[model samples]
Target: MLPGPADTPPGPRLEAAVAAVAAPDVVFALSRDGQRTVRCGGTAPPPPVPRERLRYELGSASKAFTGLLLAELTRSGRLSGGEPAAALLDPRRRTDREPITLAHLITHTSGLPGLPRDFFRRALPAWHTNPYARYADERVVDAFLAYRQRRRPGTHWHYSNFGVAVLGHALAAATGVSWEELLTRHVLLPLHLDGVAPHPGPAGTDATGHRRDGTTPTPALDAGGFQAAGAVRGTPEDLLAFVEAHVRPSPTPLAAALHAVRRPVLRRGLGHRHVHTMGWFQHPTAYGPLYFHCGATLGQQAFLGFCPGTGTALVAACTRRFRARDTFVATAYGLLAEP
Candidate 1:
């Protein structure tokens, strides 16, 4: 496990690492000791791009929030992690696929595919505009129920966007409320994460995510039914605060829920040694247990991680999809894991 920074302010080393990343714009935040330091850099960036104010699509990092919501629900006894999802979903629409539990979906071991095949069929037609915007909750649930699993549940670790999305629907079905409302009540409201939203409002200026070409505008993807899988966007300050909550427990009433999600659930061999938590991918490094996850939209990319033992968290979001995003993540990990 990486040791906690010894009262050392993140200095040139961190900046140089981010500078080496190939993105049109990048915002990063480090949280420790109840304080956060945010930094931003880019070439000819548009207005409202300050370190604290810049907003980017969190991509799969949003899954952590969904996982937290699941944990919270379990703590409240509203749902059981081990119960069959068929209990929550409508009976008429249930699929022939093997019965899965809420825990299976949260841990990505439900054997579901990353997306329903029909999702691509619907999305490809409007590839440039917004593939996900039209997929409402009902549609997502229908697609999920009709699909077949490629593997047996809990046998192997496979990440599935469809699994998480179905989990969200099940939660909503059990609660009789929209998934957004569930998230707002259980996580966002308690955390006071005002800047986090499923959709970008006209009031705030968002950093435009650039296409892989680095010139074209990235398609505008919406949360729709996959809202739980990906679709949250937030300012750097808001995201940093979210990470801070995981670094240490927040004072919110949902503290138990927050702590519950961080508990390591299973181990996986993903090239690097990794322990999968409810949402976050966890690793034990020489310094400490590293909890991390990365996100990507059609254009934007995001990375977030923290070590509980060290009380250090790294939150980075970038606009402009590029090949070096992985390299940038490795560099950030190297810096954070340093002694």
Candidate 2:
């Protein structure tokens, strides 16, 4: 019953933006003045739907949802960011690894590797396919337990997919719910994001992902236990709604939780001022600090960012995945830099 691209007419400004990026099947959404404008470019597949309705793998952008869930749990007094995450998991799962706090996981300072030690071993066979396809929850936990600390916990700002995935699992253990259910109940439902899915394939039309060639079907990341790391699938509209909440939070049930997530907690340098909040990276810009995150699957690239000074939030998604995928992120930063 949702409207497709034909029903939602796009303007020339959006057309120009997509063309400027040269991204195939690009969806762009901007929020300003309590209003939202969404549009898309490039070719779509059968049973055409509006680009706003086209869903793509969110990749690590899913980490923000996990971070929000942590904030919500904190707001409700269910958990504290300072607690040792190892204590929350089953004793058998705990190891001699240096203790990491929930805060470390949220800020990517847990000193865990970006991927599990065993990740490459398992992923190599399916390197071109879905690398995270069959990783089980138990295995994910075991990998965390076996991982040696690369540095003392909280001493470095290393981005670790393994750390976030462990955080998701620890929260699940604390809440007795799956990460997907926790996300839905704590974040998605409260935000009214009906278009977001727990995994790549779901009901309704999903935008077909592409390779650098712009034609090959990119494999969807059917991550299991690693789902927390990067498995969410959603449309640009849904992502815009999420960023809007960050830009201009209302007195919604999650206002306090949202505020908690955006609080600047860790600075990256002695005087550089680059910062990291719960799930967003704060970059110094002419328009003040821009809080943003970018995600990538095998074939899709997504960028979501918001500028507090301008009250503007933007989302850019490309159906094709390539080395230049970061170009979309650069494009988003440029858009924020606009006066």
Candidate 3:
């Protein structure tokens, strides 16, 4: 699987650790200070693209970008984070309790369910391949309007794809553009993530996603109703470029928003384990504050993390989805946690 011109990743543990994963291959990207490295590990056949340039589904990791967009829009005064999300929704349901705000949507404090209304009816039919392919835009808006919040907005931290998806929709509704267009205009272009998109791109440029067994290939997922929550496919090179901006001073337009996303926004859940920024999860490591997020499709997985104090950013991706065990997230976090 070591088939690219990319530099070998540093650390005594990284090479052996990433290479040992059982999937078709894992591309591990790392950057510390200003140095960068990308490495590929596995026995399966390599793709035509360079390891650093090969695209993998970012899944939920796309939320960090959504969070950045939220910050950038707020900073630009183009959109108000404190404004009610219902204002942008199609149905604009009247809630008697505290209304859900755009801030609540990005922070996952909007008391919405993880999946949309009647999701099981669609998901049950294609659970193994692509569950989200049928949950279209109209269904998503209907779900939001149908929601009844027993708990007030911002009272709890629930990771809701539905909530973030609505955030994407609301931003677009306010700006008179599509969610993909908003993300491209604000985040992707500013970071120079040239080929990254919310939907699938050209087929040959992407690594085929496979199930854990490494034999069954799964269909590429559409963000469909969850565009802001997931639905991005990108290369390790671009991903490292994206995470680096969080730890390194950037000349990009998103600099302030990048800094804004680093602040801890909320902590809720059992034992107070769920600490978060607008998009990324914040964990207090012995080294410093580490912000990270992981994403998964039916057949692929991705992870992104950065430690501001250590000046470290990392991305790890696998071509196959695991049923139970996941080595990428914890392993990448450990490498970044080490000085």
Candidate 4:
């Protein structure tokens, strides 16, 4: 079994950091020096939320997993990274303009729009109970078939949930297995992460995602439609373990692929640089570079990030959406700072 923080105590500096961010029910784990680790916080005491029960909606963090899967397939020669995405769709569905390749999808450089307009206006309300709960594979295919190229495929980067969704379809078509199955076989199982489950909550082990406000619970997203886009949920420790595995140097093909995924790709927004390797945002900090991502769905706000340089990972999740006065990246760094 992987020894956690209990095996190695944290220093005073780290403990103070945890106390500072203790308000929002934050759960954090760090493995500086790659082996010695420390963890703090919980929804409650005496095992506040068991790693199994503390399910957090990872938001776009799922994109990193998707990118890793794609990279692994490409490295193993099962799929071609350079193949145009149009090849995966029916010819009748092909959009005009430059071709989109798997690389473009991984890098968010395909120039596709953030999401189809219909998704927000039409599909969103009905599925609003679960946002993406009702989106089916058939609708995904139809959307791809009907989509028009909004910009050239490789010239510029644009973050598009729709593009990643299409890539998920392409992977499914290539592997002859559903994306959920692929993730289970390749990621969850290998990482010994039993807590990670596909969207809509796996049978017998998952928590409902609630809005920040006290409104009704949002319906879980259908993993089939979101696929590798934004569907998995798990506890912060499970997420930390996953990060630890990536931080370690290994010769396995998957390990190498994960390393590749952390490569910086483009600039996302203020103080945030995008990583196409695994769809994470890289934020440079005083300690080192922090690889992080945040998600917001109605009333929920979630953030997960770690610095490979420092072996520090911070995860924060809230039932209600909370806007930050300063960038979360800065806030996190400030918390982890040596006092």
Top-lDDT candidate index: 3
**lDDT (Cα) of model 4:** 0.62
Error of 1 at 209 (Å): 0.7
Candidate 2: which stretches are off by over 4 Å?
1-13, 43-47, 92-98, 201-204, 324-326
What tens digits encode model 1's per-residue C-alpha lDDT throughout 144-231? 6666667777887778888898998898888898778999888888889988877775644677877777668775557678988998
Q: Model 3: how far is 228 from its true place, Å?
A: 0.7
Ten contiguous residues with the weakest lDDT in model 4: 1-10
| After superposition, candidate 1 runs with Cα above 4 Å error | 1-8, 49-51, 92-98, 270-272
Across residues 1-339, which tens digit of lDDT does each residue of candidate 2 receive?
111242233344455567655545888787764477776776545336666787878888888888888999998999988777777776655544568888888788989888887778878887777778756788888887666676898889889888888898988888889888999898999999998878755544687778777778866677767777788888888888888888877656799988877878888777957788888888876667788888888888888888877777888788878685355666666665553
Please give the lDDT score at residue 309 for candidate 1: 75
* Candidate 4 lDDT by residue in tens digits, 125-167: 6655556655677777677666777677777877788888888
lDDT of 3 by residue, 1-339 (tens): 222222334743557657667778688888888688777876577667665577889999999889999999998999879877776775445544478889999988888988876898987787887788778887887788778786789887778999999888888888898989988999998889986878877867787888878878888886678888998888888888899999974666788899899888888768877688988998887777888998988888898999988788988888888765566666766676666
Question: Which residue pairs collide in model 1, if any?
Answer: 1-285, 1-286, 1-287, 1-288, 2-287, 2-288, 3-287
* 2 against 3, candidate with superior TM-score: 3
With candidate 2 superimposed using the best TM-score fit, by how many Å does residue 124's alpha carbon deviate from the native?
Answer: 1.5
Instruction: In angstroms, give how far residue 211 of model 4 lies from its true place.
Output: 2.4
lDDT (Cα atoms) of all candidates against the true structure = 0.77, 0.77, 0.82, 0.62
Q: Predict model 2's lDDT versus the native.
A: 0.77
- The candidate that wins on TM-score is 3
Give the worst 10-residue stretch by lDDT in candidate 2.
1-10
